[model samples]
Target: MSTEAVTVPPVRTPTSRGSDFAELSRRIKAAGLLERQPRYYLLRATALGGVTAATVAAFVMLGNSWWQLVVAVVLAALSGQLALIAHDLAHRQIFRTRRPSQACGLVVGNLLLGMSYGWWMDKHTRHHANPNHEELDPDVAPDIIVWSQRQARSSRGIARRLAPLQGYLFLPLLTFEGLNLHASAVRAVARPGLKQRRIEAVLLVGHAAVYISALLLVLSPAKALAFAVVHKALWGGYLGAIFAPNHKGMPTLTGNDRPDFLRRQVLTSRNVTGGRVVDVALGGLNHQIEHHLFPSMATPALRQARPIVKDYCREVGVDYAEASLVSSYAQALRHLHHVGAPLRDAA
Candidate 1:
């Protein structure tokens, strides 16, 4: 296989970061190892099955006043994970068959994120292709991308620091100042595509109607609100950590700084969760190194790639960061602190 040299930016370290990233990308592409459709489908079925059962369980267990909050949190987490499953399925990164994945994505990912499969597929494909590029990537919303170039004309330092942390756990801050929400909005507005925009609009309206009707007409407002808030909080927290770890703390792009696209994903990502919890909790996404090596590869294979990728990272002198769940969460926070340091710009 011919190896491509990746050009690094000024802010980047003069190391093998880009090369390692490139190597993984090349391996994945050459191997033709994409997602394991059957395994992915099975995982989805199990997670969704659990979620559906849990929802019924939540209703049945709602009888426990003391455990209501606990049950709610669990239920919400299940749904969020289910949504992510749908996301994987939709991308058919899990299942190459578009029709099956699309059907599930339309149902689960949309319902879970309060979004639509049609709209998400379009923008998300663009994001994976060009992450953190101010021009091409509309994913800059949320707390990650603050201050337009207008806001950062001079003091890039203060501008970055001044960005909002939004919220920590057990707080509703994330729900109100949603990064994904802002991302989809800005992206929809900027892109001049009416069809995708309309799809997004329908999703939002459809979700809102469901939320309202469920909360008002079915469950007590207290119950509905409780469910919604807890569920969103769970999903939001996961998204926050994943996004921050992905590229926010690594590098920003001018959209033309790099030619090795797949390599950048490798350098910018880390794999965590080396245990069964990796499977039960993160769906093996913690094996980001493996995923980078094979974008289309299923999550189960991520564990298999962990050792190979780690050794490769070490051989090349690039950091192969892997931590337990506890450490990864802390590292994620530290990452936010590092990247979130204020940048002062008078724009």
Candidate 2:
């Protein structure tokens, strides 16, 4: 067997057929789960928000100084979950129009993750548009590690070294406003066409005012710090893990080329868990494959939509890739090992 003869495996990992996709997509579309029931979204948002707020409140109330650390960690996890909700609402067209989504996403995104809704939506939209295409994907900024195999094999490679820094250290620590935050910030300042700077100013200033007021008016810095720390650790780590797993390992290519949207998203991204839990907690992240297929669909709707799409894919015999969080992480590490400029004709 020649080295050239060792064929790379097809991207799909889960064995799905056309029937699965048909039922999932058709069922999802038929369900008319557009823009999720507002009550559902509101209830979910409130519940998650309460859980997060309560956790921090306890830390401050209990007077356990170190509980601040615990609070921060818990907040981080909760923040990640909350952010997912905002993410769903941002994309879910169930809202009367983009305005409502903007309103909701802005308020929710800031409170949950301290990121600008519009900024995130713009970058994310591009990420979806380009997938692994190196040229067009605006989300593939300098701070992010590009994926490629040749880069992995190179000794003491710059790209490989950066992966650990970005994936593990900076990513988990910084949350949304990590080093990449500056690039977007700079972009917003330079272009200012997308309302990025103004939006960011609001978030930052708003955060400062609230935090300062808390410290001055009510909770002490110690208490506030406790909440902030825990929230950052858990939510930051969770968000980094979810986002990094999908694209890190799959494949990298040039702008001239493109992957079939369904095919590439399926290959590059993997669904973590499934069912309503995902639809709710993960904000359709569980329906990651579906969301990639039709990002315009609201995330909450992905739940009903997943089965529809799954059935459709099954009937079509498209191999689907589904991984447990643990498996996904293992693959993410491997994916990080490869990142480079895609050569032309290297599909």
Candidate 3:
């Protein structure tokens, strides 16, 4: 048959179903989980805080030697884990009111992790508002790395060269992510216009003083430097590994394609399915779809909320993507590779 005369299949537009957000909200409310369970979260916060403090104390008390590197690495992991607690606090998941939650966020974010709660909230709120929207979502905004096909293909010079190999370089690049976050947080606080900027900056400065003083006082200069490097890099890599799988492989939206809240969050988020071990490690982020839907829910509650959200999605014809840890990573890698293919071909 001639090409012009042949019939071609028409593209099927996704049916515009009415918003399920209100329904999901009702289900979640009926589940009676939106209320902050102070006991559970407070206990979790205390345990994480105590463990992180003890680890730091151990690091300071220990001698400056090869073993200090191991301590530094451990401390970094703890700090990364502590960040998860800070994340929940920032979302007001543990507290009924904003002030107490903000207080907890300051303690965990500034004192414990040496990061800025204000800066994180400024960025993270936008992410929740627009999870995968290219312009609106800070998570997918242009960074040191290119994450989309358009970005990769349009990149120039050195970035263009690196775009093609991003998937392979993803982990190695993540090793530097800890330092990147620190710099970004510092920069954010350094700028004017943020609420209570001076106080936040002071907290950050205090953290820097204490952190550096303890390390330098307890260890030789070379050892201290080594410790800092190892700790920060490991913390970055650990966090990257856990978080990248949540939405990196999922759909990316443009500003105009505004889906309703429930559909937007569920379609863009991917869940990592394992057991409680993975759950704990990811700080309940493994159930990303559920967590995005019910961000204020306590971490433990996310797992409980998963079935409800999944069942709702199935009934509503919404996509709920989930996979094992390894599988999710593979999917993300494939996505990266696909996005960067044009750059690879050009090179």
**Reference-based TM-score of each model:** 0.72, 0.74, 0.92
lDDT of 1: 0.55
RMSD of each: 6.4, 6.4, 5.0
Writing each residue's lDDT as its tens digit, candidate 3 over 211-314 gives 89988888999999999999999999999988999988788877476776777788788999999999888889999998888888888888888888899888
Give the per-residue lDDT of model 1 (tens digit) for 71-174. Answer: 66676566557655765775567666777777667566445456555666676777777655555665654333342332233333533444434213213334
- Model 1 residue 109 CA deviation (Å) reads 2.4
lDDT (CA) for every model shown?
0.55, 0.57, 0.81
Off by over 4 Å in 2: 1-28, 31-35, 141-144, 150-160, 163-191, 196-200, 212-229, 274-281, 298-300, 338-347
Residue-pair clashes per candidate, as listed? 19, 55, 0
Model 1 misplaced stretches (Cα beyond 4 Å): 1-40, 60-68, 141-207, 313-319, 338-347
Tell me, by lDDT, which candidate is best: 3
Rank by TM-score, highest first.
3, 2, 1
- What is candidate 2's lDDT per residue for 1-347, written digit by digit as tens? 11111122343443453433344454566677544476766776678868967985775585645545665666666767767766666666447577777777767665435566677788788888767555566644433354444433342455445544433444444364432443454455446566646765677557557755654454467666555545555565677665765555555555444434555565555677644554454555666777787776765566666666666666545656677666766766644432332321132
User: Which candidate, 2 or 3, would have the higher TM-score against the true structure?
Assistant: 3
Candidate 3 backbone collisions, by pair: none
